[model samples]
Target: MREISLDRLRTLVAIADHGSFAEAARVLNLAPPTVSLHIADLEERVGGLLLSRTRGRVQPSAIGETLIERARRLLADAEQALEDVERQVQGLAGRVRLGASTGVIAQLIPQALETLSQEHAGIDVQVAVLTSQQTLQKLADGSLDIGVIALPQSPVKGLKIKPWRRDPVMAFLPARWACPDIISPAWLAAQPLILNDNSTRLSRQVGEWFATEGPQPTPRIQLNYNDAIKSLVAAGYGATVLPHEASTPAPESRIVMRPLQPSLWRELGIAHRAGEVERSTRHVLEVLWELEAL
Candidate 1:
């Protein structure tokens, strides 16, 4: 079967966009007869009438509509292919897909990305909010380039894991409510607690902290988002154990954050597939490393 010409496809799209073959020819810098012939060739190849002309305006027929949609995709793909080639030749523009947990995304990723943008304006970073386990799985599956995740994860074959940062877990309470200077697990467990759900590694750590003192206290609410948990705490609904970064003070905020007595900390790390890294991924890693040093 004969393949459709991109030029002819472009002509069809132009005519549809401008609502007339003459207008399309003007925009495309092609003669009106040339544009008409291009459409004729496309229709013959497609084995259907591709357009309907009324007065001076033109509209696509049903088959034309289908081919027009496909044609747009083909054109877009062609353009993207060209752009990718150009970016490769330029040696600085590329896309990197990075995965991390919600807390990392909120607290650290933005600053890292800000540094990345300053250093490499042409590089594009795409972020996915995923659990550490999910991030590891994606990295192994080649879906993600880099992942910022909670460390001390169960060993995964062929992954490069390096410690990133440590953040202290703090007890959050309403500022107006009476609370001790430093919160103990027993004290925290006795309150109406809004805890991180079991899906997060932090939740498991918190659970273990509670388990050390016999029976675990059930939470009044289990939530994943720190911001949402803080909102509830600020409203005097209940208290929560979350990262210290989550408790960043807002002006005249209703919430107060107190350190845990036997300070519990969450360890985060970066993971990537164990192999030769691509230039863009390496660039991102370099930026992250520099940020880590600072």
Candidate 2:
């Protein structure tokens, strides 16, 4: 601020453009005395004359002309910076960082982003594929604005978690199998399964569902990727259980998506910082809620 304050710079530019200190004062809504003080302060700081009187009118001195040109650019940039911030505050423009699992990111998030693009074209959404634990950690650290995480999550400080979707954990079986209208934990336990890795919450939920029926079933192969699991099921390698997001397309040929009997659910929650959320993030949260399953 000591080098050259924006206020004094603005005063110099105004006086030079109007060619009259009184006229500049009137236009700037500053008193004539305040305008005169601003010019004196600027000249003292610059160590030179900034104004000259020629032919009974005021004009910029040689040094003043150079300073004024640079000042105009600075003022324009400052004004534009303010405008950009204002747009963000109003939720008309901003970049929102969102974190979600690979499954949700592949299937559901794109729908929300597509609507966001059409509605708030200036607002950009940056998505990251992360596990629920990773998502919660990112939200706590302020590196992320939103997180679509699996439910039954442990509480984290400085974070707000809300239930977003409760999708039925459907059994994706090979079409060649003698598939029933609704799959049962007992029947699925007997079949070759391509289940999620044991580390995931979905795997735990699926295990618990089968544990209730009888002994927990083992998987032929455990994977973390839903698309890969479905692809294997399509190849008749094994059956897999996955959450069916609302409005998603049907499964590929040779793969049958059937709801599990006993109605197991894969619940998801949205997480964000607990306080003072940015307007752009709030707008994105609203758009995400629009995708919630009934």
The CA lDDT of each predicted structure is 0.86, 0.90
C-alpha TM-scores of all predictions: 0.70, 0.87
RMSD each, Å: 7.9, 2.5
Q: Can you list the residue pairs that collide in candidate 1? A: none
**Candidate 1, after superposition: displacement of residue 233 in Å?**
0.9
**Which is the leading candidate under lDDT?**
2
lDDT of 2: 0.90
Residue range 94-121, candidate 2, lDDT tens digits: 9999999889998888899898888888
Error of 1 at 230 (Å): 0.9
**TM-score between candidate 1 and the true structure:** 0.70
